[model samples]
Target chain A: MLEAPAVAALTILILALFVGVEVISKVPPLLHTPLMSGSNAISGITVVGAILAAGSEHDAVAQWLGFAAVVFATVNVVGGFLVTNRMLAMFKKNPKSDA
Target chain B: MSSTDLIQFSYLVAAVLFILGLRNLSSPKTAALGNQMAAVGMLIAIVATLMVQGVVDYTLIVAGIVVGGLIGGVTALRIKMTDMPQMVALLNGFGGAASVLVAGAEVSSRITAGDVPTGIIPGAIVASVLIGGVTLTGSLIAFAKLQELMRGAPIQYPAQQYINALLALGTVAACFFLGMAPLDPQLFGLLVGLALLLGILLVIPIGGADMPVVIALLNSYSGLAACATGFVLDNSALVISGSLVGASGLILTKIMCDAMNRSLANVLFGAFGAVDASAAAGGEGVDQGTATAYTPIDAAVIFSNARSVIVVPGYGMAVAQAQHAVRELTDTLADNGIEVNFAIHPVAGRMPGHMNVLLAEADVPYERLVEMDEINPQFPETDVALVLGANDVVNPAAREDESSPIYGMPVLEVDRAQHVFVIKRSMNPGFAGIQNPLFFKDNTMMIFGDAKKVVIELNDAVKNY
Candidate 1:
């Protein structure tokens, strides 16, 4: 039931994923912490995609699934920011405290 | 906008946000704001997708939002800083699990409808299932070790590496079979199991010293799995974002490997830190005599007499919550016009940036912190190097002897300082289970006590002096 365009799109996506892997393999380790915290933000795209796919349909199941993806993605996005904030806070030298 | 155009635009926006986030993260000052920008961009993208799709039944979505938000907010507020690494591991695992579930559901739905296409879905399913399984199990083990619920040492057995290799091979075979016949639920389950086992085996033989690298590598796997899931769903935004994460994580992992002088193959198969008895044998440094006596000096003598002071912090500084105390001591010295600098080696503590985080928390000025290369030359000129619970990073054997387990590994040259004052509870070896020769050196003095207490005492001594 699949068409050529759909197949081609999927192939391109797969190739992109492979390329991404290759790119990651090349980055240095000193940047791992910052990279992870940054990439976490990018992963939020899943939430958006899930919402679109699920919301476009009229079915209850699709709506609920999309809702779940949104929730998960939101948690990931928000938690990432919170943790990053806390981490950055640690670096903010308290000026008043001597000990 | 047309539906396709809207989706394409969203992808572009998400990609731009990712690039900006990465750029912002390059420096400590902008990292937090960068995270915020990325988060807001993600929110915008998510809302846009939902609006464009126009779904009914926002009730469940609202409920999910409430529940997820509550959990996330509470966990963020409650989790201690010391447990940050474990928290990261758990989060990474969750991401992997979500991708696996998404891929599994898609594959099952396709199979049940009698769609056994030999191309995209099958490949995506295999990739997602495999990578997810590995990431989930590996991350759990890492979390356990970081939490101290499991041993940090590599759990080894006879032919452990071979068994791990076999598991990897089995996983590949399962992936191939799944690709050939996508409808086989049994093969899918087997593949997942094999991948899970491979993940465990992969982590089991990796010692604690290499955990930061392992965690980074596992994170990359999780990102790749998510990207594969995006393909299965045909979501362009997911594909773009997931690919960015996957690429960045892998690069970071490779960098960490290079810092340790390790190859990816060695990291994956060499069973690093699972040394044999011969490898663990005490080097010539350990044969040195242990002294039980030292004349305790007053604080005034330490500050007034010393021309220059170096501060060495370790994992204990992170544990005892003594970074603030250490910072205070530095400030007190700076008040006396005594020069002070912090020495950070490449692998100073549990993770790469452990001390950096600790000191930064204490509000230690960035300019005062020095890297190993910059600080090594100043050690001889340093009148005193105050080691605050550091062990392995200051060990001189890493540079002097070829037979040492950590040979060729760069370490902070604190021992080269004119006077070394080590504040520790006892003469215990570090996580590497190797005694430090610097502890017993003629010029070295061990001040036995809790790090936090000792630092505070040192502060008091400097103040009274």
Candidate 2:
């Protein structure tokens, strides 16, 4: 069983998650597109978690799970970056027009 | 490196990266960098997880990596700009599905082990099963709607809301029962199925106009599922990241709803903006009057003689990539001593700020872009309002009739202008899937062609004038 401090820490973390979600929910539409693209970056944290899990010493099953997590995380990271690039590319000023 | 310490450190780093990435996502210029930073964080977490677990079989891992990479790369390279929204929807659905799968797998593994704590196991199983099921079904429906495979409007029946309410109640009762016996895989699966059905039923009635909001809401649902799974697995990083996504997604959804001046209930159940038979029939009392459609020269003549011109751009302009041409025309008109400006409706394109981004790309000065409120009063004084690739935003019916789906929604009031030159592909209505009555109005002249081509033609016409 986890100690009181560990439980408290977990509780605090969970509460923080709720708070973060609330903050995001209140943002206006004008900010949503940018916010989504921005949040895509934040979603990258899963990659970090996956990487750390993979790198740590673990049993075979744990190792395989960690590896799978890494693979998924990488896909998310790369795919998100590519999409964001494409989206931003739309904003590139047409070179032909000077005015 | 102890497993517990390694996991804690990995989660800490992941949390920090998530926080930073979210902060960076707040602005456009730094959004990409924020994404990169988060990716790096995710990479770190994955590596740490692997290290802690100590897996020797690289074959399966490598194969999975190769296949996933190929698919993702090809998708990125092949998809067109127009299909970006659909692609986003698909990706979001996949994320939701993944979380659900993960939760399901975890629950199954726990149950098979037969060593799970009776009290905690049931809650974990129920949370994972229910959340995952809802996320999967909801996201798939959202994807189908966005892809246009399913009708984009609310498919309504009498007492539909009441039926949905009953389904919700039933789902809740089923979830409670499943929680009482989490080790029963059959019951867990049943609960999941029910939740999935509920999600589909919830989203099916929403109209296409509210798709952005629905997509955002589904995204939130997916995040919540992931967060719930995190609780089941006791993963701090997952909880933090999932909650962040869920929260941000909900916020975006709300913003989209507000932009459309809709409520969450209306978006889910109100059948808002559904184009029924009445909407398709066009205006009832107003007699359809035929007007002499003006040519570029005829419109240019009016504009040349006029004191002010306001340009209203919509999704058509973005589709045509006519912003540059439009910009040139505006500049040419300004040079001719004609005061030119732009009128931008809040929901003018596929996504928020779409018109602004497109116009800005053409190097249109920020000052020239006018919001609907600021420019509506000026429309009466304005000699001409050139509507490019826009139909619904400038529709007078939005304000004229109470029965209309879009009625009471603020419009450009372009009909009030002395002359309205509308450049469009055809007489088709907008994404709202309704016919625009403004096309048949007396003051409006349809310049039928590609918006980009028409704008260039207008530029030439104005220059000659």
Candidate 3:
């Protein structure tokens, strides 16, 4: 829809799909929770859409919807990252760190 | 470079950071840094998108970010690790809901001004709304079940499947109608409504036992919805990152299903209340078994004398917050020259790697924990199999009982060990609802109590041994 050709966008989409699957094939089972939560944070990139939605001056209704979208997307982004960090923080190896 | 080029370059940079972050996340040592890298990528993408043309007012945008960030940050920092599955589910739901709002705003604004595109935009909007709506509600239901705010068992009524089928058909029909009359908010609203209902109906039939798969699948759905929204907006960043989430999430879901030896269809539609059904039917054989019981003192003597012990922890261990106690018990055994190892079932706790985190929190050495496949063969040579608050994963039925609902699934071969001590609160069946015949076996002894208390008592007893 923008200046980028549809074919190029689709190309990115297709290649990303393949790389996504390949990157996660060997994640150790111990890190599965962090992996899921970490990838979850990546999906929070939808905050991009939320920012555009909120800033667009379509109409009062559209503005309100956009505002709400920004809020939810922000929560998804901020919360997902913080929670993932907390989980991964526990995965450290410590012979003397155990309580 | 022009602003457009800058935006595109920033997106490219973000995508590269995301890829690097994902690569680093594969190992335990680098995961935290990987998460930080992805966060920085998201920040760059957001800041760059803020510079895009359509954005007008900074007040509402700033307000939304502050309020939402405060809530999300506080909750994430405050929640117990044990409640993480539900937190993740809720976050996934918020992502889906964000997509629905963005897509809805985009389409409704366009339709309000007769700005309909003659291309795939309409279809993209519909897909975004549909998937986003479904993901939002489905994740909410998942969160509720995990939080115990709703029943964790499958909730089915007569003709539930038929009703779900009708809802799916109606939602699709509404989408087609909206495609023709994009100006009609009523039709779009109906599409969203039906999709939301379908989401609830879809997840409610699945029990808590299958939540890991459900959570991962819903996470994937959120990504797909965002990807569709990206197409509607022609935003390359969303499309790329969303596809990454959708693809990796699907793989994780498959891993969860495979770990449990169940297919995706079985997880989604198996409606595993058959155990409850037979129980309600009041079959005598199902209710007739009793397990041999032991005390903490008795377990202490057995554990102290054993040369090697393998501890298996499960959902009950999490509930009892006994990971620390289990660690102490292990330490006591170690002092007595016992080699202690932990066997972790893939779906051990409410979520994937749940027990691992809990064990790690108690400072149990990571090297001492072993996966199901790797630890299965070691059980036979182990002097004792200590099951603390674990159930179905250790059930011999998966290996021996052909008629059991969990018959074909792979389980820990704890029965192979020379002596099996099951520390539980009672003889209740686990989440799977089927009785564990291992409890009544000749070598298995049940020590009944709160897992944390029992483990502590055992630790004390062993200390004095």
Candidate 4:
């Protein structure tokens, strides 16, 4: 089912996969949880696809499904970012009261 | 360039920002900026997708954003640092469920229009539905376990492995059939049901302690499902970001396994939740029947006079919500001219990064919180190891007792310290359900009480000096 353009896309996918591993390799174990949460938040980019699916002209069943998808994906994206920020905020170099 | 060309360019830019965001997030210095970068990338992606031609139904989209944004914002603000893991699990599950719904909707709509996905479209649809279903249910079970709504121990029965294998195979077969017959909603629905069940079965047998790895793996699964959704929709941004998440999550999962000194196969198939018979039996310290106890004053005196102290925290600390009190103890010790550091095991809390987040929430300095490898050597020269509700991570059995199930797992070596003070409710074995010889060591003294109260007492006692 993949055409020539898809072959190019697959190549990009393979390369991106390696880049992902390389970037995460240096993360200190201290930040492993935040990294997981942060990366998990990034995966919320699916909100884009959710929007497209929801906006498309389709049957009622499909429309409702699309609407639900939009809601779920948005929550992932928004919640993920805000939560990651909150965690990282606590990781300041010095305790606020101590300094 | 035309408007369409401009929209595609924005997507390309968003993808690049995401990569940059991930890169920046690897270290502590730039993590916050990294998160913002990713968020901005997401915002751009959303706007660019909205700008696509033939888009409509602004009312439904607006309502979704408002409601979802409200839910996400409110929950993120209200959730305590201790509950972060479950929150992440729920969000990951939401991402998975969205992919399933979107793909299902798209397929059903195509069928309604008398159109069938030929070639790779059908395959992508099948992949999305199958993986998304698994992630959705699997994450929910993880959340339930972390939230203490259900037993955190692994749940298994006879022929469990066989049942899971059969379910996996059946789910795959259903996916293949759906791929071949995209017009058949019944086949598609059957595949979804099987995949969801497979997810529940897959996660139910994992012990609570191993949740970080499970959560990471499921995060990757969600990413793969999103990638499949990207393929179904022919969206480049989705494909790129999805593959990025899938690869990164897999690597993090491997790291979690290494930290615990166990293989992924062992975590999944080892039935770690089942209490070990041998661990339950009597041994050198186990035969003693009870650990030696000490008063809060003695612990305070020992900590105050110590040249260096290392606080090793575990799941019990989180359960007792003692991080704030522990921080107070650290402060009292520091005011007395003693150096203090926190040693965190990789799998220390119910979830990954649990201890660190808790400590950070308590305003613990980032520099003072040390990793296992970095702090192991320090234990020998240390004067006191203040163990707050931590167990198996400090157990000598992981290193000294080869017959032990946790043998060969890297531990915090707190036993090497001149004196050890353990603050626990009782002589209960740790999450692995194993007796720790460290609790019965000659120099080790157990303080019987809740971690929060004991730490507070220790802090007050130190103040008296």
TM-scores of the candidates are 0.87, 0.81, 0.96, 0.96
Model 4, residue B370: distance off in Å is: 1.0
* Candidate 2 residue-wise lDDT, B192-225, digit = tens: 7888888788878876666677767766665666
In candidate 2, what fraction of native interface contacts survive? 0.24
Q: Better model by lDDT, 1 or 2? A: 1
The superposed Cα distance between candidate 2 and the true structure at residue B24, in angstroms, equals 2.6
* Clash pairs detected, candidate 3: none
**Whole-model lDDT values for every prediction:** 0.69, 0.66, 0.85, 0.85
DockQ of 1: 0.34
Model 1 over residues A3-75: C-alpha lDDT tens digits?
6745666665566556556544443333344456446646645555455534444444445555665566556
What docking class should model 2 receive? Answer: acceptable
For model 2, residues A1-99, the per-residue Cα lDDT tens digits are 554544654685567666676555443333355455445434433433333333334334334444565455445455655766655544343423533
DockQ-superior candidate, 2 or 3:
3
List, for all models, the DockQ compared with the true complex: 0.34, 0.30, 0.63, 0.69
Model 3: per-residue lDDT, tens digit, B115-183? 875466677788888999999999999999998999898888899878888888888799998767765
Tens digit of per-residue lDDT, candidate 3, span A1-99? 333455666788899999888887767888877777777778888888888877877676777788898888888888888988987877775655532
Candidate 4 docking class:
medium
What's the iRMSD of model 1? Answer: 4.3
Higher-DockQ candidate among 1 and 2? 1
